[model samples]
Target: MAIPKRFEESFADITALATRFGENEAAYLSSKYQEAEVRQDFLDKFWLALGWDIYHQEHPNPYEREVKIEKSVMVGDRGKRADYAFYTAPNFLQARFMAEAKKPSRQLENQYDCFQAMRYGWNSNTPLAVLTDFEQFIVLDSRYKPTVERSLSGILEKFHYTEFGDEEAFRKLYYLFSRESVGNNSLEKYVEGLKKAKGKKTAKAAPAVQIQPVGDTFLSELDVHRENLARAFKRSNNELDGEELTEITQRTLDRLVFIRFLEDKLVEPSDIIDRLGKKSGSPWRDFANEIPRLNQVYNGIIFKPHAILDSPNFAPNNKTFDEVLAWLSHKNSAYDFNSIPIHILGSIYERFLGKTIIVSDKRAKVEEKPEVRKAGGVYYTPEYIVRYIVENTIGKLVEGKTPDEIAKMRFADIACGSGSFLLGIFDYLIKYHVDWYSGGARTLLSARLRSSA
Candidate 1:
């Protein structure tokens, strides 16, 4: 197959990348090529040159162009992982192809490498798979079952980075693995053609691999929760304006999640939300009454609520509140809030909470907050950005300090919306303090609290 006329731009980019790598070969081979992180970085640049969006921030709906890294696929009781999974569309219902990467020191054509790549492809049910280490790329036919006895002989084609300088070799690479070729089903077709040329009857392709689901994407679940709670709260209380209803709903979700987190962390007894579950009776009513007592017992220590029991939002008649409670409880979802990363939770809230409900003509309508939309539509400051800011400021200030000494330092964020920056700093301190004290710091911190008491 010939390279398309449109390949001119990509060809230039590939040439430039090859030249750059060739010039830095000595330093890279000695150090960077052996390190997993450094090799991953180079792979990102390599794909970027081939038109994949490595950062995933350029597109309006980043999922369309996103190259998901370290995508987990459960092989059995344990999870197996691939370095990159290329989805043709954003919903990730089907993976068009999969790519497994290795350190530059590893040979892409090695039997073990081929076996590993084939396993991921077969598990994912992708028709085409690529194994690469920035230096060598081997595209394989994953539709056939790959066996341990003969792994290296099952490949379609292999190419070296040095070969990109040869027009014929570059054309072969473009035909088998270019973004356009993969997107348009050309690569699958090429694999099929190779089988036909070898006088092999086209075996019916195996069923698409039922790859493990990504486990209820956090943002999708959060969005559904937000919409349902807003609707339920409004249905239960008709007198409140849209803004009031939104505030009440947001606060309710936040408080419940916060308590759930505490329970998971062992800071609170497990199953605090379970106290609300009932087979028959006014469970919501009972739950509402218990909040005041709870506030009296643990208010300032955990969180202080503003008369939650008195609000119509907490009324037992709002049976939908039971649904929300059940959703947050362990029986309804697999999420273990204790172990789930805090940044994932923070980012979801940051994005979903940027919209407010408006009551007009006695009907509620949800829209993005005007100021937030004007500023750029509720984009969560990516974790890397927050990391950079916090490391330079808070990290530098707190270094070489004790937990007690750190306690004396006061910090403020004037524009702490969903508190991603502040939350990051809090997480940082928690980790640093725990590391500093190792085994006994929690005991000490608890004692310090008791002394203050």
Candidate 2:
């Protein structure tokens, strides 16, 4: 159903859509409506979508039947099954038009439409006959008495705005069909707005959409984290100015999200941290151990940095900030700069993580690392997949980390196979740089990155 173009000014006042068969609707409704369980369900959805109810008087000729027009041109041909034939007086008005409803998959074409609808409408003395495949509804009307030609279908016809299979039909029907109705224009505009809103516009994720407070404690922590971040950036980047740095920090906090892969559990800081420390010993310990190993191999760098300024990337002023930012950018530009958030490691080794794969490889040729299991199986963790997981999980990852925190971020697969995780080592390294260079404002910086995504 192509949307009707209601006169913008009057659209609000009339609140009705302009209903046209061919110019607006790309397709028409089919008249053959028969009862088959599958067809009924399909038609039911179609009927409701088109604003016609079973209880209404102008309902299609039959409840459900796959009927062939008894006497018509296309006789002896197969007919489509439908739930109802509906007509409305106008837009949201009386049954001025009649239609036959069918399941969504039926395409309106040279089938039983002419044969069935002409006979049905001729017998009922109705002005319009319909053929519809829930997505696209067709409208067939009498040219003289018995002659209703093909109106809307295919291309080359000037009347192009016809959309019978979409939400646009309702908009048109209200405006065109009910010229006398009040607020016709308003309804049309409303429908248009609905369609527009429904359209895939660049919906800037509502300021990184703060989820409802699961608990005040987390909220408090989040707030403190953000505030501290703002202060840190303001303190470090005096060149960028206070307000600008503060703004960046706030944005970073907003983007902060804590995600957990576990099913049926509210993600909490303790989960990741606990798991990381629980080396088989403890999962958390295993993860912690894993991070350093990965860091050494992928980034050729180690953080286990206890001192705030121990890492050369840390900056307190202009000279240091420039160097830090440069290093950050350079590291990220590399093919394998796994950027792990600094605070994330200390907050909880469990979150903001880059994981290794534990699968068997097909060839089993390479020397298997500690975390990699090797045998006979297609178990190579592709870099793209690992990168996607870490980037996607960043939201939840930040929830557990804090500034001035750098613990060994690691991912250990108890059944490490082909070391699919090693592929993501670059991500872990880059995250480390990003978190440090962000000036403790992971939330805001993350937002800028996500918007580009």
Candidate 3:
């Protein structure tokens, strides 16, 4: 295939920019040359050359733009901003990939920078992202859950500023990240090819190493929390029986996790749990007190006071409550609940249902239920299968139907385990309605309302 004239022009511009950076490396690396400066001078040009409408020159409408600058994504209680979010045209809402820019002085190879970039991508459910500092460009596989401990593991490719003029390097960059390539599904195909290659390599290895999914790892963490909390509650309140202990422990953890989710979704104030942790009084009590207000707003049974746990006699030590709250609300906590999908949360709950708490020798322990043990183990339906079932069944039912018509139709899953199928149905409906409203229907509705008035 021949290189297009536009690509050649872009290559010349990138080469000139690289030359400028090389000639004044020290000045560019200085504190005076900030991240914004590098982004405007180098990062912008880099993406622009790749055919991204960075400034929306061709697509003036905000919703039609292929790139979003400084898009704010919620991470736990805090909001993190991505420097650039590239998208395929017509799907301007969801980003295809993110680009994080740093000043030339900053090291892109550092764990902090790598983890930050991957975290944004993982949280947003984006599959790929780029981290650059004008001096170095790093491509990251964002499908993996990011952790500061293993920040470098997800990196796919790396290149230095000096390599910008190299034909091979530029071609690799263009093929992977150019807007034309992305629109043509080149990026997806590339990732799929990488996955197949990885699977083949792992299969041929002497001892196959299975890379655990984020959901399984998170479920393990939840099991640990349940065990710890169960033991702590039993130790603190000896009067409680096994059933009471189990209920209280599960309810407490469920409430805490839900609050964290709400915080990340921006439904609740940031760090509501953290603020509760800072209280001199019982943090659990403070949190429990806030539940009523939450229930008033959201009107759900999850926030409702439990019959036994809410009793005055069911008090666990303040120290125990404080520790759990601190573990969740601490700045360095590993879990980012926002990144986890609703189906994954449902899967976790399904597994949780298969376990029970047993009190022996004044100690509480989590154990598999008799039925679950008899059946071998708890089995969760894979996300892909659930999506397929939902689409084939519900998709057909809602075809060519208006939002009101779809709303009137009832969908049911007879053996709904943790409501995964129902969640899939809900997700399909939301997207369907949004697409409908965003299209011609919205204008028609407005006209109808105006005519009636």
- On residues 39-96, what C-alpha lDDT tens digit does candidate 2 reach at each position? 3434343333333343333332232111221211111232322223333322121123
Q: Give the alpha-carbon lDDT of every model.
A: 0.64, 0.34, 0.76
Count clashing residue pairs per candidate.
Answer: 1, 110, 0
Candidate 3 lDDT over residue span 177-238, tens digit each: 88888888876788898888887987666533234555676678778888888888888777
Give candidate 1 misplaced runs (Cα > 4 Å).
1-216, 275-280, 300-319, 397-409, 426-453
lDDT of 1 by residue, 227-297 (tens): 66677656656677776777766766676777776665556654667776463356566555655666676
Of models 1 and 3, which has the larger TM-score? Answer: 3
The lDDT leader among the candidates is 3
- Displacement of residue 104 (Cα, Å) in model 3 is 4.8
Worst 10 residues of 3 by lDDT: 205-214
lDDT for model 2 comes to 0.34
lDDT of 3: 0.76
Whichever of 2 and 3 has more TM-score, that candidate is 3
For every candidate, C-alpha RMSD to the true structure in Å: 17.1, 28.4, 6.1
RMSD of 2: 28.4
